[model samples]
Target: MSGNIRSSLRGQRGMSYWSLIFYISGFALIILFASKLAPGYVDAMHVENGLKDLAEKGNIRDMNRGEIVRDLQTYFMLNNVRGEPTKSVQVIRGAEGMLVSIDYELRQPLIHNIDVVMKFNKQLNTAKPELCCEPLVDLEQYRKRD
Candidate 1:
């Protein structure tokens, strides 16, 4: 019984240094990726919350398109959101009600030559997913800041 136990113990080796290094490296990469990805997601959440808050104010229908954009710009500035509200915000007036869309993409650099792109589109009316990289709204003249 002692001889059998000794043979089994010899074959059952603990984790090798190389395996441990590989696992540690993988964990490090995951942490690095998460760190790089976090800012974009956080900014998106802020933008979405801003839209929700604006919609819940119960005065969006009375406001004109430019006014809506102006309000969102102020919110974005106050919140320090990096995405351009002028390019992202859309005011669509429908027969039923108003549909406001805040469609934007956030790109953050990860490892060299690698980037993470997070596309966020939130509407007052359950925003639908759309293709990114296209100008959803063009308010360049308003680019002249107030």
Candidate 2:
């Protein structure tokens, strides 16, 4: 009976040292990933917010393409965002307003030979009178050919 009680207590023992190490290592890995990946996400959010603010200001509609690009550069500078402005920022004249868009990708190395790739594509419309650069597709054209 004494041997049986000792065996039951041993069987119900708490986590072993190895198990504690395994759990702690997993938590540490999660923290490492978050530390490496969070900044990129935060910067992307800043870019998105900056674009939205620009759209809300309705100044992009009044500016020419070059001026718009310059303004975007300034915004990026003020927001401490790092990216190729000429490639990322695009201004297109849509039917109802000016469309400003940013398309870019960020790559971050996590561990040995492992990496994270984040692609961000954000656009906003500034309501202003402008000639549509890309012609709107006529809805009638999509009608089923009889």
Off by over 4 Å in 1: 11-13, 84-86, 126-146
Candidate 1 lDDT, tens digit per residue, 1-146? 99999999988988999999999999999999999888777777777777776766666668888988788888888888765544777777667566677766777788899988777766664232222222344444434542
- The CA lDDT at 26 in model 1 is 100
User: Which residue ranges in model 2 land beyond 4 Å of their true spot?
Assistant: 1-8, 84-87, 128-146
Per-candidate TM-scores read 0.73, 0.73
Clashes of each: 0, 0
- In lDDT terms, which candidate is top? 1
* Candidate 1, position 95, lDDT: 76
